[model samples]
Target: MIKQTFTSLAFLCFALITFNVNAQDFKDLDKSPMDAASFPTSNRVTEKVVKVIYSRPQLKGRMVESLTPHGKVWRTGANEATSITFYKDVTFGSTPVKAGTYSLFTIPGEKEWTFIINSDVDVWGAYSYNKNNDVARATGTVTEGNKSLEVFSIAFDKDGAMHLGWGTVRVSVPIK
Candidate 1:
């Protein structure tokens, strides 16, 4: 009985210490993530359509090419693979994609960016990117925006073209 009591006390102390350490870790996160969505809100007449769930990574002190090197696949956001869901069949450029969920990835380049839709879902990052699982590929026109963007953002326009902006680089891909 004495041995069991001593063991229980020790376990309780260890658990308390572990909990305290984990609780303090949340404060270290500089950029708290957010989930952004497309479509109308409030009294807008446009019905809901596409949506994206991703972490908004900020450009605190990082360069665009340094963060997303040329010729390499970018998850598009901070954590977890960027998810793009389509409520209806849409033509991404000239390629038609069915209404479903897919992993959104991009290859940032100096001239243009290549938008990718992969069949593989629920992936963590570009580490699991496979060309074999790619469903569609579209070229996005990269242009310089008038304003400097601090955080990486993905938003869709009224014409169903989704735009991605980070720092000074902006790219758009038509989804309708």
Candidate 2:
């Protein structure tokens, strides 16, 4: 029991130190900080077969296209590269991907956004992103969100289209 208590106290001290160091890095930001999110796109069976994990970045009055850029490659989500996992082999946007996890990236465009599923699952932002590691690519058109979103969101439609929305823009890519 004493050992467990000591370990817990050590963990708490580490957490506090890490929080203090990271908080100083973002002190200039007035609001709309970056955050993480996760969800499953399918409810098909007892076990969940599809999942997405990503960081949500707030728009903070910035244009989505301006923030993400029109042609530059993006990590799709903030902080770490957005990742999606498939519990079973499934076709995504005309490409067959085996059951595994992959980093989700994109190139935002005015009319359409090019989506990418890459073999690199662990990465930060898009600093280390490489096109050679891309496993699949698909193009999806952009649409208006139902309402302006202050925080970026990634959700799956009932039909299995993964919807990515921020500001007034929304993009849907089919995952089957």
Candidate 3:
């Protein structure tokens, strides 16, 4: 009985120490937290047509133009470049793209934004962006929103239109 008790105590002590160390190793939330948006967002619709994973960066009292300068390639989000996956072949804006995952980048303009779907996947910021690897380029109309969004966000409407909004600027890209 004493041996069994000692074995149990030893195991309990080891478990406690392991749990304490593991609990401390957990990291806090990222400053620019990752987010995802999918078409057919309805819970009943298990089949997704398109999906985008990106990081949300807060405005933090900074201008949108300052964060994403005009006439320059932006990663489309914070941290890693935004990735967009299409479950099947579809027309994005006016450009036809095959069913695959691609890195999403954008060039901000005064009245429109050029949405670039690059073949490269799992890339960091646009530091290594190469225009030659572009799969498709589409034009997204930029419009002023009545309500300002503090954090950058991407969402898809029921009609499969992708909308990107930040600080009162809204860009809509149609998909069919």
Better of 2 and 3 by TM-score: 3
Candidate 3 lDDT tens digits, 87-168: 9999988889999999999999989999999998899989999999999888988999999999999999989999999999
Provide the TM-score for each candidate, comma-separated: 0.80, 0.76, 0.87
Residue 89's C-alpha lDDT in candidate 2? 86
Question: Candidate 1 — worst ten consecutive residues by lDDT sum?
Answer: 39-48
The predictions' CA RMSDs to the true structure, in order, are: 4.1, 8.4, 3.6
Residue-level lDDT of model 1, residues 23-50, one tens digit each, is 8886555473867767543237555667
Segments in model 1 whose C-alpha atoms lie over 4 Å from true places = 1-32, 40-47
Local distance difference test values of all predictions, in order: 0.85, 0.82, 0.94
Worst lDDT window (10 residues) for model 3? 23-32
lDDT (tens digit, per residue) of candidate 2 on 1-176: 99999999999999999999998784465343444333343334456557888877877777887879999999887888888888788778999889899998999999999999999978998889999998889999998977999888887766677788999899988888
TM-score quality measure for candidate 3? 0.87
